[model samples]
Target chain A: MSKNLVEFNNISKFFGSVIALKDVTMHIKKGQIMCLLGDNGAGKSTLIKTLSGVHKPTRGEIIVEGKKTIFDSPRDALDLGIATVYQDLALVSLMSVTRNFFMGREPMKGFGPFKTFDVEKANNIASERMGQIGIDVRDPSQAVGTMSGGERQCLAISRAIYFGAKVLILDEPTSALGVHQASVVLKYIVKAATSGLGVILITHNVHHAYPVGNSFTILNRGKSMGTFEKKDLSREKLLGMMAGGEELDKLEVELKEIDRTLKN
Target chain B: MSVKSKSIQNKSKDERLRKVSRLKVLLNRPELGALGGSILVFIFFGIVAGDTGMFSAYGTINFLEVSANLGIIAVAAALLMIGGEFDLSVGSMIGFAGICIAIPAIYWGWPLWCSILFAFSMAVLVGYTNGILVVRTGLPSFIVTLAMLFILRGATLALTRLITGRTQVPGLRVLIENDPIAWIFSADAFKGLFSWLGSLGIIALRQDGTPLATGVPASVLWWIGMTIFATWLLMKTRYGNWIFASGGDKLGARNVGVPVGRVKISLFIGTAVAATIYACVQVLDAGSADTMRGFLKELEAIVAAVVGGCLLTGGYGSAIGAAFGALIFGTVSMGIYYTDVDTDWFKVFLGGMMLIAVIFNNYIRRRVTENK
Candidate 1:
């Protein structure tokens, strides 16, 4: 039996002459948090897109549950239990919590063509799942717009889990959240990982990633800085490396020179 | 993952979901404003023009006929608005579809039933084209359907003139005399029930032992049936959820695997089909089809939808609400003829009602989405 839930082996993607990802290898295992840390335009989005079946790699192969997979479309990826929750693309604010929880895949009742959406069953499941994650929903029928940003994030996450998501790819789930809400989401992330689901938390915030991450994969200009186990990496070292240590060193010197000119 | 037990127990695990109160549910309904407005209009007319036979069975049916004709279109418009689009071509489509039904059946000696089917098929084609254009070009439905409005209207006028040497096509009455399905669009339903009530004196009747209002208009029945069907689709079907999601956030809905494009396109077809039904009812009832029929009806449908609590920005509405909105419009417009008020004041009433309804809708939305 394979220990890894997903494996991206030497994957490279390009659009015309523009290389978005190059020689990137990453893996997610059962019950593990794999954080993908990168600056803006560091090929993080492209990598997530490739993994979620939005884009196929021009080179290399993707393996899911040790089986070689060809992601011809997003549906193919979803069928393989790969769910991606993009920031601001998770919930419809104008809809009820239950409706947003079961947007595309709705539970039906009755027989033949006289079928109906089972609102009672959906509300039960939605509220129960949300409650399991420590969010006591005030009302299952409440509009998602009335929920806090963190709770809405939880709803999206738990919804994915309920729908049989084996591997979760979250794109900057906490980037737009407040401190308290971000902490709430981080706690849920750990809870999700402990449930034996592989999670790939994508963000540039080292602080947000370091505490929850079991392993780190830093992306710099479409290239990998290699993966590191949490035990072997310190918070300070990870932060410096993620910010491009050598680039920051050169940038600090130029900033000091500008300060000297200002003093004159 | 014992998240509830193992997590630092700051929050209580015994917390249960709050029970939704009946009053809150009523207040939260999108149709509340329209429902209230309908009652107010009905009562006002009853008090002001009670002696004028405005509330008589016959007169009530008169205004209901007016309301039903508009309600059929308004309900479909509300769905499209909730799905985040508009069909400005609806009024023109009504006219075009009328000609499509009448010209063939009257001039070409085609069966009335075949002409009805032909008109509906043409509507589906136009709707498909409208949906395809909006989806492929990524243009605002307002602009796209606005162009459709002009093109359809011009085509109806030009084609009618070219074929008949005039802008009107008459003689549909003779064609429907022997048709099987034409009665479905006539004021011919509930004849037994209406006559029984007339005999019992529950309903006023004229000479010859016949009820003045012979039967419930098929238009009213169609309006109610379509409204109920739309409500069920919005609240009890997977496609209903898709409509809400597509209107609320297209990109977000698409990301979560909702077929947003298909939802929008289907909604366009729905509006076109509703317009064809409107045309069929009008042509059969009037015994004629004119290029000028249904002029500005598209805007009236939209106004009714908005008054029914549909958001202009999309994502929230109710079909029943739209029905009530049409009811109010029909009552006020028709009730004016029975009273001393000038008919011209109806336009002012319309604009005023629209602004007030929008304000009420805005308030309700804010109240529902309030921060805890």
Candidate 2:
């Protein structure tokens, strides 16, 4: 069997009286893309938050490389090579690209008590990393606010990859992007997955997900509709299951009845 | 191969970024506005007060002494503001800290250095307390530091009155002269250089062959040194990045594992310590501590920071800019005397210049970020 980098073993999370996630079980192998398909409130965020250590699972344990592990904060997850590029992008716009690239993890030079941030080294690494992803950073000292949304997304993803992320989770990376920009980000996803890092790509766009996803996991109203391999499920079937085909059918009939009543 | 990064194919400018003009890049600098403003002020003063000897070595040093006093606090203000907090108590800290040193050195008969050390420690405690209150209670630092300002001012007045039965502690010049470390705060530097210049006839000399201007004041050196250190701290260190991040976006920075609270606390301490340094220089030079000293200097320091191009909202600013802002202030306040303008108009000029600086900064930010 291929080595599983991380396994979400029957994780469930509840927010007081609300069941945000229920009995979700999935595993990500090294070098595979696990696309998470869900609607607006389908617990995709909650599930990823659990994996990224923003929230702990109310029930069940997480196994990483065959050992049960727990995470208290996002930093803990980062320490174990789990990095999440949140939907909001978590960047300080006023800061420079190099500073944002190494916000938490800055490279230091000098010995003992006289250590300093290595600006030359940081600028080189940041620009190089972004270049690998096709972002020609003219100046690493330019403020992040000046960059396009797509470039910012690429910066975040590339930063995670550069810092040695074993598992990269991107929450709705392409939702706010334009057509060309979306394609740019999609390439980064494929690029990341092919680079041997296990990726959990969260998106509602079936078209964006189907092209790059190795397998798909569908979430509906806090319940999992099972994970499916690309070959086992056709693109049409995957979209149908992701949008909960039966629920859509029921809504269509109900809407038609309302239309007839209004006409009468 | 999947584990490795792919090579870049596109060697052109990023298509997503609009072709920004060189002018736009120049406008993007935080210090540009302040630097421009400082130049304009200097030119205006040069034209109006040229024959008044305002630009001469002696007159220049006089205004510089005033500028240095405020620049020290303003540079520290810029840092704290960048770290996303305010220290309104900075002005009151000067008065309180001086008294703290003066009471012990003169009244209790302690060593001057020991008293100076005591004052700095107290400043640390005050700064740390302010930081703790702001972070732990999640209150606005403006309000917390404002209360601190009043409390410190009132305490300084009350304590000075109770201890010595007077508002001023005077006549400590002999003691200061005797003290080993007082020269760091009180004495002028570069005396030999000035004497050499006098001998070379490059500068005006007195009957004893001493230059009209003896040397650079210790305060000026402190101002320049502190500003340089602050600029370096902001631009070249991990802590500098964290300060920008912490002020830029609290949650975003915290999510990325930046210790926002600790960074802000250290910044608060910086301002307090800067205030203590200001107090030491003044008290040592004057050979006295007065309760009325440093009144309303907080507003002046903020004005300097704001004029220097630090955003009132935090996250964006420069220490060099703040230093220039103080330069403009000192020049205008002192230059008015040489130009036959009432010193009262200094406040008017200060307000008008602050308004202009703020407008310029806002316009530049809008123009640059318009691409977004």
Candidate 3:
């Protein structure tokens, strides 16, 4: 069995009077993809934020590599080899690809006050790394805003991998993409997992998750339904649970009656 | 065998895709519209005032002198705008710093060097206040700096009157006439070159039969030097990256571990210091300081930056472009006097040029994005 890269043990988060996440536990193993499924307001964002160090859990601990750890900031989490690619991708649209790739941690050459950005090294690495993820960026100088949504996601993911992230959390990476673009991003997620990195993909789309997810954790209203291995849950059963099973069935019957009355 | 040929074909395709045309690369530059606009303005003014010595060597220097005075502040303002902040107090800082220097040296019997240092420290203090207020209070920089503008202007007026019992302080010439620092900061540069040109009848001469050897003003040299340094800073340094990122998306930059607050504070301080430099030059050259000095200059600086291709939205601009924008301003302001047009109509021309430049910039940005 692969080692668990990170484990969230009975984590709970509260905001003033509201509970964002409650007694949720999950683990991601190295070389595995964990799909976090939840609808709107299901506390999925809060859970990922805690894991990515944007928020500290109110009750519980995060174990990383067999040691209890607390992350004070996103930088702290990043230093621990955990990176999050938020939906916005944290990219400056007006900046060039190379500039965006090395925005905060730019390579510098020279000594003392004379130090300068190593543009040549940045451009070459940006282009090469992007090509590795099946994006052949023609020019590293191209502005990031000019790229397609799928390409931007690929760029963000590849950047996280290049920076030595052991566990990557992608927040709805494909929610804004078209059908073809979503497939392209799914391919990249699988590629990232194949490279021995743990990945947490957050989305409500079971169709998308069922294909690449090795394990799935479904959350509804701040509580976990269950964590299931890929072999244990079929697509139909997962969809039923996601749509609130009986509630959906009742809505379907009411919709049919309305349609018959309109026809008459 | 089929696989091998397919791999070769893919490599060729990638190579072809990477080859962009030179024209396309040039057009994609942020300063492309500014560059084109500057050239067009120069030609238009040159034709209208051609015979009136507006194109002559001496006339060129005259207009450049005007531009250089404004260019120093415009360049700094461009950087601040790129960092997504405004310093409306820049014009007021000029007036205040000049008073700080003059009242101490000319009225209080302080040494010239000591007076200059006092003025710079005051500038730093004001700059710090502006930066801290905006960052800590979460107030818009426009409102913060707007308050600073009035505060500094009123302070300059009140202080000058209280110290000297007048609005103007004179006698700076006696204090700085023999000073070496004055020669470096306030003297005319390249005097020998201009004098030699005048001797050969290439440049104009004074009525006393001597060459008009006040060649390029020292401020122009400083403008050029500062412009080069600013361009290098924006294009080559890691700090430049911070500036761009901070302006582009503050939240995104913070998420990526960029210190957005520190970057903004540093930019504010830089704009104030630039204004102080401009004040020093003006006071030393005129040999006097007035409370009304640098009135409405901040608006001109912002206009120059906008004409230079800086988006009012921030995150995109070039220092070199701002310098050219200053040049266009100086030419039109001086060129109208040489032509038969009404001098009062200069403001109309200025407004028209600014509008045209902004439209051109927008069109270029859209075209570049579409082309990609």
Q: Which candidate is the best by lDDT?
A: 1
User: Per-residue lDDT for A175-240 in model 1, tens only?
Assistant: 989999999999999998998999999999999999999999999999999999999999999988
Task: Report the Cα lDDT for residue B63, model 2.
Answer: 94
The digit string of per-residue lDDT tens for model 2 on B161-242 reads 9999999998667788678888899889999998898899987888987899999999999999999999988888889889
- Which candidate, 2 or 3, has the higher DockQ? 3
Number of clashes found in candidate 3? 0
Two-way lDDT contest, 2 vs 3, winner? 2
Pairs with steric clashes in candidate 2: A195-B2
Deviation (Å) of B340 in candidate 2: 1.7
Query: Which segments of model 3 are wrong by more than 4 Å?
Result: A243-246, A253-264, B1-12, B15-20, B178-180, B207-209
TM-score: the better of candidates 2 and 3: 3
Model 1 misplaced stretches (Cα beyond 4 Å): A257-264, B1-21
DockQ of 3: 0.59
lDDT tens digits by residue: candidate 3, B56-141? 77788889988998999999999989999999999999999999999989878888888888888988888889988988898999
Clashes of 1: 0
The two-chain DockQ for each candidate, comma-separated, is: 0.59, 0.51, 0.59
